[model samples]
Target: MKALLSLALLLTWLGRCTGAAQVFMEPQLRARAGDSVLLQCLFLDPDSKGWTLHKVDWLHRAGAGTQEEMVFFYYSNHGVPAGRFKHRVQWRGNISRWDGSILLQDLRLNDSGTYECELRLLETSSVFMRCEGSAAQVWGASLLLPSSVTACVPSAPKPPGLCQQRGQPGPGAC
Candidate 1:
């Protein structure tokens, strides 16, 4: 018997650059093998005008203390998904709206790790100051919103209390 326990993630705005863009993310997720999950990330840009994006990168770590690798990257109009995520991930957010979210499909046991979303602007020479809640700096060009999921595969006979229990605001297919 196995159990899949899903927990919520924390979102903290850690910057002080008067008008620089900041990121906000939903909680982490939990699901079973063959399920799909959405990693949400939204950026709030002080400037009402649409901001130009240089690149959007999605990184993943196999587990705690493991090295992070590229899951997907978007530049210009082309997106490249790497490694095991080559055909299982999708970019479902619009950068013009400051959204950098993604949809991860075909969940696998080894995919149990931390996923991070980073957004870099095309304009780097300009010094922007964003002071919402506290920060947003030149050093803050990259936003890190990492979400993780814990999953499991049921053994034969499917013992009681071994099923995954997830609710509200998550993938309904689980």
Candidate 2:
């Protein structure tokens, strides 16, 4: 029985670890012009505790645009771009099993186009590296945020007491 168990384990490892590590997308889906879709990415490796997902990036190409820049990027709440997806994206992979998938909320029509998730990992020797895979044609409308919300966002928060200082002085005068 011990020999049989060992054989089973070996076959399982071979099946999941046989080929080059790659990212896979799910749902076999489609979305309309104003719909939001969640794209999931997985890295497969039977051996080891799964590939380390150091980072995930999204890219887009709208109409004739020549491969536009990164839509959003994240690593420990940092490296996020000031774009349409600035605060609408979140990643929950750091908590368990190191899943690199990201969840995007309130997706817009402009969010359409080809998207890619970039994965970075350490090889067997602990060497750092990165790999990227693309999302299928995401058909949606041109990217645009509501004028009211856009106007409310400031470049940065006002320093503490700055607002109070505007209408008063020395903190003692009326």
Candidate 3:
């Protein structure tokens, strides 16, 4: 009886240690100015138990000493983008699919930096039968854009003589 109880305790300790070391996936993304990029954050529920995503927040940092700014926040099925990024960021993730990705549109030169995704999970009796605590998983990645790639802007229309038709090459007739 004593040996059986000791073995059970050892197994429980090992399980907890492993669970505490869970890792969040981060993939480096590269994009040009004016292109959209998706920063992904996905994790595996070790015990096969589900969790209720309470909040999702994305932060951005340009360099040292600079405060990490909140780029986007999503909760209660609504997404809010920060100040200047209000018209550039979008929530492209699905809670049911365990995806916490965000789409950054119209990328600018200053957008080249590190982006972090933080996911807060809520405990519920229905899905998470035995949650230890409110789990906040974070994943981050760096985005790089060449300096030569400038933000795309609308250019003035070309002369009618230089215009070309659909499938046609050069500045010739259709």
TM-score of each: 0.60, 0.49, 0.55
* Best-to-worst TM-score order: 1, 3, 2
Clashes of each: 16, 2, 0
Q: After superposition, how far is residue 131 of candidate 2 from its true place, in Å?
A: 8.4
What are the lDDT scores of the predictions, listed in order?
0.52, 0.39, 0.47
lDDT of 3: 0.47
Better of 2 and 3 by lDDT: 3
Instruction: Point out the higher-scoring one by TM-score: 2 or 3.
Output: 3
Candidate 3 segments exceeding 4 Å error = 1-27, 46-50, 123-174
Top lDDT hit: 1
* lDDT tens digits, residue span 1-174, model 1: 122424244443332333334444333345545767766566554344455755667777665578988888777877787988999998877766655667778765566555566566676633222111111111112433233542111123332322232222333332
Point out the higher-scoring one by TM-score: 1 or 3.
1
Cα-lDDT of candidate 2: 0.39
lDDT of 2 by residue, 140-170 (tens): 2443321100000111233344335344453
For every candidate in turn, the CA RMSD to the true structure comes to: 14.6, 21.7, 21.6
Best by TM-score: 1
